[model samples]
Target: MFLRNQWYVAAWDYEVDRQPIARTICGEPIVLYRRFDRTLVAMRDACPHRLLPLSMGLKEGDNLRCRYHGLLLDSHGTALEMPHGERVTKHLCARTYPIVERHRFAWIWIGDAELADPALIPDFWPCSHPAWRFDGGYYHIKCDYRLAIDNLMDLTHETYVHQGSIGQPEILAAPIDTRVEDESVFVTRWMPDIDPPPFWRDALKRDGRVDRWQICRFIAPSSVIIDVGVAPVEAGATVENHDQGVRGFVIDALTPESATTSHYFWGMARNFDIDDAGFTARFKAQQGGVFLEDVDVLEAQQRSIEANPDMALRVFAIDVGGTRARQVIDKKLKAQGAAAS
Candidate 1:
């Protein structure tokens, strides 16, 4: 909830082609559209003239023609044409945001203009490499964005909450190590002498034998990247000669729309072949359902917290990562006088 001066994924690259799409990030309504040249642009959705939503407007060539007064806004959010005049006036323009399209997603900076740095933005797995494949999309959640981040940082809950999906019983007893650096927190757990789950059996080519496993990663205010690796098993354990084992990464970006609402944008990347349409579709569907399950629980938790704001909560060692995340958020919010904690 305190994620200001950060870049958040706004929409999938394919979602804003040739059409005006409206979204809210950090409580600010925004509109995104592409020029005829396919370059993407983003601006406050409201028209500067009358405060009307510009997303309700139309795309005329390279400009967005406001539906209210037919004002033409260029890619830079400069008012190119007003019904009453011909010269472009800087005073009659919407608040523009710096936008960039990369890795099949559109990213927007929602903070102080001077603090916008693309280099500081978290990098997506598949988006950064050609060896990986990704599925891009998002989900609207009823819970606050902080809750979504807390859920991701705490893997211990998966054993019970996601028992049917990526969860494993052995992970519950595994010891976790936590670390914090530069406002980012990371947690790592190693599970040895454990067999691969049914879903990962094919991917890892395991043969009912014990092997080293690792889940380690970093999480910032509204984003995370988890790297999961499995040690190589003996040969002839499964079909033909598949690579020793597989390593996969899960990357997510959470954007807060308001105190009680958020958008979860996530994707998975693996070293294995996910190029086939069948495999991609199956994986996306499976993971998507697991995310929905998380949404249900988090939304309920947010409601309970909202109902009892003064309730004291207890924290265990397993909650270290989540607690640290909240601390960083609280500190940032307090510095900016934003609501947090």
Candidate 2:
């Protein structure tokens, strides 16, 4: 079972156009498109008659026409025109979903549309904040979304997975503190006065001893924002507030497409180089490369988990952060189940 009545990102705001696109979220196939007025719409992907995927239909004005028989549906999923001019009734409509475009993302509520409050959407302010430049790409990984959550919550794997780009030996030695507050989980690591990694050195534009930090915050259901950056040793940047340094918030939102497949939206919102479009493009490319490494590891790990079904996964000291996040998910899921019953 998955968390319901919560906002799950469906696509980047830019991904939706007048042409319909099909996406599966929480095992529900959905079709998304922008109306003539540029407002977005999300609805069940199937046509009510014969159950043909509406995403394969043609866009006519703000409505969609099923390619197979030309059954037309308005943006609200109401059947407007029946094929062969047959009389259309209100009961011929398709189901629609609640969608909101915010912080450069389009979010859809998976259940209980009446309970899908816009206020419940995850706070991704850094992506929309005027002071930051944000850009990244998406990946469809063949693995359970929870595995991706675990990978993000536990950064120890970076020592090997991303060693060529952003990894550093100092990260392995840094003491990690995992804490839980309500439904949120925080795993913070502080590496003070250590040699900067190659990525940090390039971003800082100078090589010297620096204080680096990685604060991985998990917002329940499936979102992880990693606060990472470095500052000169003399800068005196503390873990509480680190604006004195060049910092970036690594934005991640995982939407489950199935029990073993996920839609991974990843990006970096940086306070520095806000005006450098070229830098943003270059960095986005580099970041995409780094995440591809993770995709490979995660896909392999998923296959391994399936092959060794008798062997249950184990948790250790390094998994505390992910463990806490899972606990929050389990609690919420239980509450939702009870409410439904």
Best-matching candidate per TM-score: 2
User: What lDDT does candidate 1 reach at residue 221?
Assistant: 55
Per-residue C-alpha lDDT of model 2 across residues 24-58, encoded as one tens digit per residue: 99999999999988999998999999899999999
Query: Model 1, which residues run further than 4 Å from truth?
Result: 84-89, 210-216, 232-244, 337-341
Candidate 1 residue 320 C-alpha distance from true site, Å: 0.6
Evaluated at residue 276, the lDDT of candidate 2 is 93
Give the whole-model CA lDDT for all candidates, comma-separated. Answer: 0.77, 0.94
lDDT of 1: 0.77
lDDT of 2: 0.94
Model 2, 69: alpha-carbon shift in Å? 1.4
Give the lowest summed-lDDT range of ten residues in model 2.
164-173
